[model samples]
Target: MTQPILVIKDMSIVFSSPDEADIEAVRQVDLTLTPGKTLALVGESGCGKSVTARAVLRLLDRNANIPRGSILFQPEGEAATDIARLKQDSLPLRAIRGNQISMIFQEPMSSLSPVHTIGDQIDEMMILHEGLRPKQARERTVALLDQVGIPGARQRADAYPFELSGGLRQRAMIAMALACTPQLLIADEPTTALDVTTQAQILDLLRQLQSDFGMAMLFITHDLGVVAEIADEVAVMYLGDVVEQGSVYDVFARPSHPYTQALMSSIPKMARKAERVRLSPIKGTVPAPKDRPVGCAFTSRCPYAFEPCATIRPERTEVGGGHHARCHLLTRQPVEAVA
Candidate 1:
């Protein structure tokens, strides 16, 4: 197997202060991202999709508790380091954060500083990491803006986040993410709020940038359409657990888990101008973190669930080459493959 840029093994996360009960948000998620490839982490809201990405950057709230697991990250030319064990905001982790692995947040307007020019923000990373002088950093910043498809890069660098259009602000965000040419990029729903046309443009730009930089990307989103467009591998999450994972072609063409099947079916397919289209919504709501089912977290919502599915926790088992799913239904005959 090729060495993965990141290896998240049996990772679990909880949120709890001294007085409150623990809210388990992520449960033993294991994911891998090979160099220069895009791994899509797909799931609906509250499925720990965003939380998993935040955990990698150690950007969780103060109450976050990671009791088990290791986020082993192998920088392009360095030995692997376990990020889970690193102290938050420590010098080493700080250097790794934007220098070795950077992230593009979901909301560019919120992530970018309203008080500073976009150039100032993007320049800060290179200045801090590479010790480039102010003039040199500014030049690099303008070049980055141009690289991410921002028009009038030099002038745009002086603009504030609120001053730019949504797509432009997102382009600025991508520019910041690629400023250091990090080994891994974690993009958390970076195109959620944009129009379809703008979203397509941003996706295309990201694909081009990722290829040019040769950086591994952990793409987090609930949109299967986006997954189909950009992902090399797909991990389907349900109620804080990754229930199914495989190559994008395999997972979309042959979803092996009940939850994955339902999600794939939920994707909206275009119809002829005259034909009416409908999405097959998933049957039940996601269980609350505090009230998750004891056996399989998705058992309550799984249609093909059996007595064992409701009584015993299903373990992840390999269904095919590099494909695995957590479901008791797989223990018997194979689940029906969806198109």
Candidate 2:
């Protein structure tokens, strides 16, 4: 079996409040991303998808803390570094963050610097990480922009973030992310803001780049359609905990968790006129972190939730062929049987 490029084990994130008790945003969660594969973290807003991705690079805010778990990143031919344990500003982390790992944030308009030209921003990464001279870095930056399908790459390199269209700005961000040929790329809803056409182009660009570079990717999105289009593996998150995970095919074919089922049902599907039905939106919204339930985080919204689901947390139960879901339904033994 191929070794995973990144492994997250029992990871949890918390935030300290001055007057209130600490808010635990993420619970014990486990995930693995093999080299050259994409793992999509799917959930609604505030489900901790972005927080988990940010944790990989130690990019959380000052008040955020990792109370438990380890984020192990092992680039080929290098020793594994525990990102959770590394000091935020340590030299080792600084060297690895942009060199071996890179991220494409959701909003490029705000993420990219307005003062600096796109060329300068990308060139700086090479100059800092690859130790390339200014001329060499600039040449490489132009090549990267061209490689990502940017027209008039050399001229666009001098353009400010505000000067380009949303699609072009996103392309520039992708160019910057690929400047160093990072081993791992974390894309947090990179296509959410773009129109359908531009979104498809970005997705294709990412696929081509991943094929060329053989980079592992952690893709964060709430779109199941995108997951079907891009991801090899899928992990369904509710509140903070992962409720179901497996190869995209397996999970989509047989979603065991009620929450996962609800999400799958919510997708707009085509049907004959006579067979068409209304979309089934899940009942209720995701509770705030402090209001999360004691047992299953999804119990409140799950239509199939029963007595034990409200009091006894279910462990991850194997479905088949490496598929697993955290729900009492999969356990086979009913509440009456246990009682």
Question: Which candidate ranks first by lDDT, i.e. highest?
Answer: 2
TM-score for candidate 1, please give it.
0.94
Write the residue-wise lDDT of candidate 2 on 1-339 in tens digits. 788888899999999989998899999999998878999999999999999999999999999999899998883437888989999799989988878889997799656899999999999999999999999999999999999999999999999999999999999998888889998999999999999999999999999999999999999999999999999999999999999999999999999899999999998787634776788899899999898878899988888888788788789889998899999888756337554
Candidate 1 pairs with clashing backbones: none
lDDT per residue as tens, model 1, 93-140: 998887888888779976688999999999997888899999999999
Best model number under TM-score: 2
CA lDDT of each prediction against the hidden true structure: 0.89, 0.92
The TM-scores, one per candidate, come to: 0.94, 0.96
How many clashing residue pairs appear in each of the predictions shown? Answer: 0, 0
Error of 1 at 203 (Å): 0.2
